[model samples]
Target: MQHRPQNWILILDFGSQYTQLIARRVRELNVYCEIHPFNKDLATFADNPPNGVILSGGPSSVNDENAPNINEDIFNWDVPVLGICYGLQILAHNEISGSVEKADRREFGRSELIVDDNTDLLKEIPEESVVWMSHGDHIKELSSNYEVIAHTDNAHVAAVRHDEKPIYGVQFHPEVVHTVYGGQILQNFVYSICHLKGSWTAKSFIESTIEEIREKVGDDRVICGLSGGVDSTVVATLVHEAIGDQLQCIFVDNGVLRKNEFQDVLDIYEDQLHLPVKGIDASDKFLERLKGVVDPEMKRITIGETFIEVFDEAIAHDDSYKYLAQGTLYPDVIESISFKGPSATIKSHHNVGGLPEEMNLDLIEPVRELFKDEVRNVGRELGIPEHFIKRHPFPGPGLAIRIISDVDRPKLDILREADDIFISELRKNDLYDEVWQALAVLLPVQSVGVMGDERTYEFTIGLRAVTSVDGMTADWAHLPHPFLAHVSNRIINEVRGINRVVYDISSKPPSTIEWE
Candidate 1:
């Protein structure tokens, strides 16, 4: 049963990527919330009604023949409502008589939100506050009950609020990092209008998730897939604390792991934390299936499917392991099953199946409710090593796909050496935390360059350094030329099999930072 916290906010998703961000921002305030499709009957969720309703931004235009719309009953509901982007347009069309027109100046990118002198929705958002906009259609006319409260240079009606009802609408997206004070605006909505209690913190999530896991697992033995990331470390530590010896953590050393990552991770869990863990070196198995696989998607699938096979084999040795536990965080779970399940964020972070379904074991996730940063906090709370918690984001494929071309042991070794040097330099300067992600990709195409008067054809190492809040969007980090020069010099001079290095400067829109 979904626990309904006081004064909940119901988010009706319209298939916008930003919809989950809306719920995330609301949840950040400790206000309970739920997300559902726009067309879901209001009564379907009214058994535990939200204190307020939020309509999410979407791709479809309200004028489209099949555009999604909120339930008509939502209008009659005695609660506050806030509509965003396409949501605002839907509200406009439902309340007013005119349809949305394809905009001559379709709003995109960052803009200043000029607020009306008298409006509560824009109450503390400040005049000329930064906002992110993405929409092609504009509300041409206002209904009798709706009044234009805020506007942008391109959008005449950036925001609207009904004077009589607690309904408000905005054409701009306030749920993204691009929008300054966007969080404050959402805080205002959650606190002032929805009348929610701000008590949902990492500690609260930890307690609730632990209790839920205990109830589900009962006396059955649980197997935790320790992925050696902050997510897995925290989850395994929590379950260990909860069930002690009954919980067994299986840490698979997929051959594609970062250079020496297998042993280093094993040390932390077994030696440092004294965890009930077994380190399985299935690198040979994983690398065998991954040979010559160039497509990134295929690489992920192969690794995922292989992990399931290896884990199943391990569990076979101990029939007592009845539960298959994972360190799946909220973001990963949300995007994986969003279209099919109740999660709003899962539509974004699809962690393709790492395990096969035939290994049918009762599923248990201790940290399913936690986000990335929150998982780190819980790791610290559970006495995990600081170094493990602060480690850079490591994709589960290990290092196979990080090598932009064909997967090979020699190329993998060189790339790891270069990556280690890059990370070491970043750490020496205390710049690791500042960088969102920094990795070295070994480009397949070798260039001819004279080294010590000897004709040499060596692999080029592509250096990617990006700054991002979430991987969904990112900007290239401007490492001081001196730093880049030092890293390039070290990789070419100290590390073998590389003569050239290039810095990736493109942002997330044009580039994903990862070469592959």
Candidate 2:
């Protein structure tokens, strides 16, 4: 079990794509929230119940034969409850069978919500405002025990409330940004109805995490693998604060990292952060293992196993280390786990899914439940420098995955030079902090290009930059065309082995941030 805030909200997820978004919104209000599978046993939190409960939207329909159902025990807790999208339908189905059914036309986009009663959940929300709707099933008839609080033109039962209890439901998604009053509506529910104090701040998390780490680790030494990314840096600093010299950090060059990344990050860890760290250049070993590995999954697994081997060999001389700490985040865990059942694996993250089953040391992830932005917030509270805290997220497999082909030293060198130019230009143009993540992918496709009045065949580089609140969902950053032209010119002219450059304009649902 991990350390949790005293006043927190419990979000029961029914496999919604936006389940994490709901948690993010709640956390934005300064109230801590956790997402658990809908069928999770409530008895696990019997001693430490949440101040309130939120049912997240999902892709499942309540009328389905094997649909996810509501836990009746939630009512027994007597906590304020708010249901969203599919959550609202399930509640009505539980109250009265067959109350919800398929709609003639699926509502999949923005819709104006008309608030009829602005007493509780809809309190302070605009009388008529845009609300995001993405549901095929709607509450056709609410139970007699419930009253309609709000409605859209298409969805009469857009929002409903129980006659007596502090239970409410909404058909529209309040977690998405498309909903104009979404944040305010959630603020009302969490603050007004639930009476939560919104006490779960970065400082509070750091204080509790420090105490918990010390208690769990005791006098045993801990070894942490630093990736030079924000996540690992924050973890090392937080752990170092708790156990001081008891923690040992190791940063290895995997032969696929950005140019000068190994040494640059090592300097920050040792000099700037004052953490006990050792830098190892195991690029040759990593590159040897990755040679001829073309499949993305295989590449990830190879790098992960190679990383374990390096760490194990580095600490082989000493058996004092009892724990292995990583900077695993919430998205990594969510995307890695087949939480929705079999075939739910989106892609195996190097840190989360690439690890071997058995290891010599126990795993301790300090920020396992936090999102990328949340981790940055924790970094700021921990006194990490502002510039370091805002660094773009670097994948664990490094440029290997970005290569989009088999691993090799020549390919690594090409990618490193190209990526350095892209990143350096972003920083120089004052656009580094504008996007969430940006990288240059060395595509294997080669075409004839005219350079110095000569025809030459060279590799291509794909530029990808995205804007996102968290890494879970993203939209390609709309960088200026002139800026793009300038970066493209520099990459092709300065870096060798590159002919063409293309910009990715796809969003998360259609295309992920990374090509691989």
Candidate 3:
């Protein structure tokens, strides 16, 4: 029941950090799309070409030696090609003898776009609209087939279109949220230019996923590592509906969980949803294995390996559970595997690419294709309570990542108490939904504080709250000053942690949402 797309758009990634943003925008219009490397052989997609092809912005200059390029056959595919930033430069270099010259001044932030052409791509966009620009190269000359459609004050050839072809190019990034009417521009391209219908929906996704699970997992037992998040819970719900009692849910208490989260989630799984749920108390085992480990990636690997080992050992006698169902989302997949195009590893998600090779289990990711927001939509469609579905995303390694330097019981206790207070206060103030993710990171550096009359030294906590549509891009939440003062004072007074609590004001480009 995976709703067959009326038309598909293929986005060739050119190493741009914002490549996924383009795909997200297209998907928002309910059209299907896929991302592939720019260097993929043109022959690979010759027979089955997409309705449109988008060239993503990248870090490399077109004039650089051995720059990334697509085969000349791509232009002959009879598909609309939209080039963005470095993308436009590449097309200029390949299609004509035009060279991408270094700009006198680089455009990094918001810029004014003067749209001279009311063509299909920029049909409804205002003439003097603000756009997000991040590029150092500019196309001064165009081929005979192309002409300037729009320009900024610095970028003369801000946008161009082929005379009689569907090819188009833009210097500014319309995919980012910073660009006004960005989504609407993408909608015009998909609906007006490519004629792609907005047919894909949550109902279609749910039906398709249930059908897929039923077909692929016929008569086989599935062991799912349920984290009680929206991702895993929705996956478990979908699989349970498909395989019924054949699916077994394993909830591991890895010691680094939120305050009182284990019993709360377990009760919901067992009594509420009525799934075959089992709890594993491996806190001591996990803590003992992670002793003295400090590196973030190393901690992730150790925690991931340990989880697999625990699962393998737990199900050693039971040979029926041959498949491992995970709640791996689209952001996790893109971060882990999409960076290097076809096969590359970024940061490993515990349930995704981090699993050891020796584990004899096949993965069944029911919600892997959906983003965080889409997953929440599916969960809502399945009747999950808003309170549960709206919970902020938690890492699989739990609070270990939030504990900056080392992992220990004392640090865990301090972090947990502080985190509980922070989250409880957010919920109390009705600001929980205003942020995508919020956490208290226990910094290794200790600060001096005066309690009553004596001097005390303890750990400092970094409070982080970010707002994002998808986990790909984010901006730090600007909580009220009174809220911050109250939370800081309460944490210093109630939790026996550090004296100072600082808020993270940085956004995603310069800083990640998490301190680690």
Best by TM-score: 2
In model 1, what is the error at residue 494, expressed in angstroms? 2.8
- Backbone Cα, N, C clashes tallied per candidate: 6, 0, 0
| Top candidate by lDDT | 2
lDDT of each residue in 451-485, candidate 1, tens digit only: 89998899899888888765656799999999999
Against the reference, the lDDT scores of all candidates come to 0.78, 0.90, 0.85
- Tens digits of per-residue lDDT for model 2 on 270-382? 78889999999999999999989999999889988888888899889998888888999988888788754322777888888898998888888999989898899999999
Model 1: worst 10 consecutive residues (lDDT sum) = 341-350
How far does residue 107 in candidate 2 sit from its true spot (Å)?
A: 2.4
Worst 10 residues of 3 by lDDT: 337-346
Residue 87 alpha-carbon offset, candidate 2, angstroms: 0.7
Per-candidate TM-score against the hidden true structure: 0.88, 0.97, 0.93
lDDT of 3: 0.85
lDDT of 3 by residue, 235-262 (tens): 8888888889999999999988989899
Comparing 1 with 2 on TM-score, the higher-scoring candidate is: 2
Candidate 3 ranges with C-alpha deviation above 4 Å: 1-6, 41-49, 105-108, 337-346
Error of 2 at 370 (Å): 0.6
